[model samples]
Target: MRRFLYAENGAVSVYLILIIVPIFLFQAVLIDFARIKAAEKESESAVQAASRSVMSSFDSDLQKRGLYGMVLSQENSEQLFSEVFAKNLSSGVTANAFHFIDTKAVDGGMRVTPVYALASHAIFEGQLLEDMKLKGPIEFSLEIADKFQKSGVKAPFQMGSQFAKNAAEVEKLIEQREDALDEAWHSTEVMYARITTFHLYYQKRISDLDAMANRIGLHTIDELRIEINQVKDQLQSLSNAIHNMDLSMSSMMTASPQSIQAALSARSNLEQQYSTLSQKLNDLEALVQLIIQYTALIVSTKLEVAVNERDILQLQQSIEPVLRLAKQKNDDIRAKLTAIGGSSTSTTSDSQGVNDVFQHVSLIGDNYFYDYQISVASIASLFTAFHLKIESIALYTAANTNQANAANDAYWTLVNDFYSKKSSIEKARMDANDGTKAKKQTERNKIQAVLDKAKQAIGGCSFIQSQSNDEALYNKLQGDTSNLESANVQGFYQKYRQVNAQDVLIGNDVAYDLDKAESTSLRAMDILGVITQASEMLRDELYVNEYALTKFNYRTYGLEKDRSGQAKLSNELVDPGSHQLANQEAEYLLYGFSSCAANISSAYAEMFSLRLAIRTVENLLDPEKELLNVGSPLLVLLVAAAQGAVEAFADMNALVKGESVELSSKLSAAILKLTYKDYLRLFLMLHSDNTKLMARMQALIELETGKDLTQAAAYIQTNATSEIRLWFIPQMMKLFNGSDLLGCKVVGTQCQFNRTAIVAY
Candidate 1:
């Protein structure tokens, strides 16, 4: 060994050979390791990228589903998985496949099942596996086989196995995602159903309320109308009675002496009758006032009640609890309906059917209930008041009738008395006239005196009776006459005269007595006139009272009518409230539907993301493993070693042989310092110098001379003091004059730099 070592012939060459060979081997190993590491890193990065893409896809799907506000469905989950698969597979990774299985096993068998699959073109029998996987016999197995076989490759390079494992994991994730999606969809369905039910209930209630209100209103108006008619009839009757009294007065004034006393007695009775009639009329007026007050009270109360009912209905319909429940039901229904393919047409039809049925029932019941109540109350109150008013009126009528009867009796009594008195006086006067001349004169004087006394007594009695009648009539007629010349008044006088007065007496003394009687009759006629006036006044007062009562009745009627209107309005509002409820229900249903859609979308996205992640891991693990198997480790390592050595040598050489580096730095600094006018010259010089230096440095750095100077230069540079100490030189130049070095040139021993100066001025 010593001889061999001591041998000088090829010792240097041999030593050089030994050292170089070992160094080469070491470099080869490093390069081989680096290449393997790089491949592995690349694969990992691709897998990670794919996983991230999958996650993003899932997240996007979830967002589309509006998972926060709604629910998810199965369809959404499937679509999302498919999309993720497409995106992930498109990446450089190997073939990817997606599958799902029910977590709940049937008959104790595996519930897991293959749902979807994707494979690379390089992979053979891809369809066979895909089809087999769907057959349900292949129990939850995920396999990713590369086009190249795993055999005949280096150790620790089972790419296919790794990919298969990754596939399995991905499939598992997809299954989990699918399960989540199902749960979300179920929840959405439940919520939808609740909301729908709530809406329907609200509408039904509103409809019922509306019907009741309308019926009440109609009843109120009818009652008012009836009252108004009754008042009008009463008024007409009073008017007719006044007209007849006027004629009775006119006839009394034209009677003869014999009738005068009878007329006076009749006048006295008539005056008494007038007083009674007036009192009866007053009583009727009082009764009417009482009815009016009561009617007003009832009307006001009914109106208030109607208003209250409307408010109560509104409150019931708008309650939050009701709304919430309805919304929930709506959501539930929507979900179920969607699942069952219940389109909008079917739902709308069903809803309409429910509404029609409920409306028919509710409206009938409500109408009946309200109408019955209103009708009963109105009829009872109105009839009772009417009965009372009529009874009072009838009593007044009876009293007036009695008074009239008394007046008739008195009139006839006075006529009989007047006839009797006239017969006696006439006999006495004849007897006196037949006596002696002295006796005849005395008897004539006595007869004349008796005649004068009789006339005076008749006159006084008629005057007193007429005056009394006139006073009574005046009291009755105080405020009744409208024009005192109506057709009613004229007709009244004609009828009374035809019924009560015509003829009484005729003679000289009789004519004189007739004239006196006529005067008394005129007075009595005037008294009758007063009585007629009183009757007219009473009639007018009754009419006025009737008018007042009618107005009160009308006002009461109006109140009732208004109450009915309000009730109707309240009912009308119920329909709107029902509609509002329906609308709310619809909104709830829509919300449910949206939630379901959102959940579906979210599920899809999650599935897609899981599939994508699986595919990414599979691709990275599979293809890279194949590549590693195919390539020879030793040879790959040798090549990498050579390249690294060459690069290191080149970098060292470039640093050592680089000429004008210091000069270039100086030129750069000079260029930086240049003013705008000098920048062009410096830029041109630097440009040329930089170009030449770069070319030379490039060749040296490449180590074409086969030297190692890179390490030495790196060490020196690392340890060396910084010659270019102004770290802010560029900034300073930019600040002062805005100049940057563009190029550098070497000329003999000097270097020129070119710079471009940005000048504001």
Candidate 2:
């Protein structure tokens, strides 16, 4: 060996052998170390994967068991852990030696220690094993162990306790009451509005009726003044004539020298007086005849307030009570409810972003309860005013002179009376035809024909003359009378019947003069013949007089009933059918008015109560602002519930918007648009805690990449250490204001990474 070491030529060979052997041994060590290191790395990766896989299942397990009822058995846990650990094993590695060395529980999770047995590869078995340990057949055994930790964060929920149970019941009650309130309030308001509108209409109609009646009254006054003036003029003229006549008569009584002189003066005065008296007499008789004829044409009609007072009164009676009931209910609710919680500021700046999907913004305006209250009040006031207006309308009687009281036959009665006279004439003619004759004139068929026609032409002139002869009755006649008989009773039936003044009955253009001998009588006959024409003139004047009494025998179409159950003449004043206030609308107004007050009162009470109760429930949901941050099951459920509610809001918004796409009415669109979140937010506000709710929160924290995700992510760098980018831990911490996740212990804000090393010699 010394010679070899010194010899250069042989030394080279020996040096080569020595260097190669050592080099080979070093190579073996390096190869075995590489293989072992590779295996160790694989094992570590597998452990990490198993841990995460198991931890991620926490939620699923909690779901299956129920959030409140968590029964995590150790046996079941071990089975899960084993199954996961085996699934993550590297190829060629068996778990025959794999066993649980220890198990422990940690905050938010479970800790498991599992040891793994593995075989060395043939590449590192033979010489590498001998060098490390003297082993035959190279039955080299290796065991790898690691401490795996799995965790799950849990939220607290109190679904069955006093706070939850009672609050839930109260919440249900509040919902029911709110629904009732909405119905009642809206109903009452509708009634109030209808009644008010109808009452306004009623007022206008009644005003028109009043005006019409007042016009009639004015016309009657004018007519009465005209009659009084005519009578007064006649009286003045008569008095003057009588005074002058008396003076002349006195002068004639005393005959002397002074008497002779007085007689001459009296004679002149007597001539003037005679002429004046004659003129006055003619004028007075004509005036009296005219008055009597005017009386015959007069008629009296009853006028009254023609309102649907029965229907109107029903509304009037109903409104006050309903309003009172509504007010009472409001008061009662206010009394029952205590103080509610105040609102808290929100952290979210883009809260309205949630509403972008919806088309309508209903909760902001008239759709809200506060506005509904205003609506109710406004309608109530209008109805009250209308009710008063109805009450203020006067129910009175007025004279409608145009309406007839009895058989208002102007010409028919005359014709009938003429027929009666014809019967007597027929008998007279028969007597004259057989053998008799008038005292001087001969009665013939041609004369009879003329008499019959003249009789018709004369009409009721004789009767009219008799009525005209009633001088006192003529002076007493009013503007319009119900009966002509009563008006001219003193003068009626006092005329000379069967007068021989044929000239008076004959036509003015007649060729023959029947009474040329009686010129004075002939003049009277001419005047009497003119009576029919005058009577016709009077009847025509009165017929068109709007205020003149007319035959009101027919029922007034739609006027109010009088005390005698007769329809008043106001039907002419206003159209009853056109005014539809007294129909169904009127009845509904009554029902609503009657019930509105009570309904609204009850609604108000319940609404107020519900408001207070909602506030209380909100308080219970979060007693303090901090409760929202607490890592309890209850809080988790609350967030879950909120999340669900928000999601539902989005869904509802989508649904309504979709349905209302073709709608024309913007108001309907607004009304139909709604979201549960709007109400839910309100519900949350009344919370005593006054904490702002965080939206879309999750609970999970990942401690490693392989265990947290499907694969380990690594960034390429130059001469840089591998940076352990912990992506899951942060993600979990951000899930909520909590530090635990997947039943894993979060030590001082992080999950504790449990690692273990196994050694066997």
Best by TM-score: 2
lDDT of prediction 2: 0.29
lDDT (C-alpha, whole model) for all candidates = 0.27, 0.29
What's the lDDT for residue 750 in model 2? 36
List the candidate 1 regions with Cα displacement exceeding 4 Å.
Answer: 1-265, 286-298, 314-745, 749-761
Model 2 residue 75 CA deviation (Å) reads 4.5
402-440, model 1: which lDDT tens digit per residue? 443343233234334433553464345334323212332
- For model 1, give the 10-residue run with minimal summed lDDT: 714-723
Error of 2 at 689 (Å): 4.0
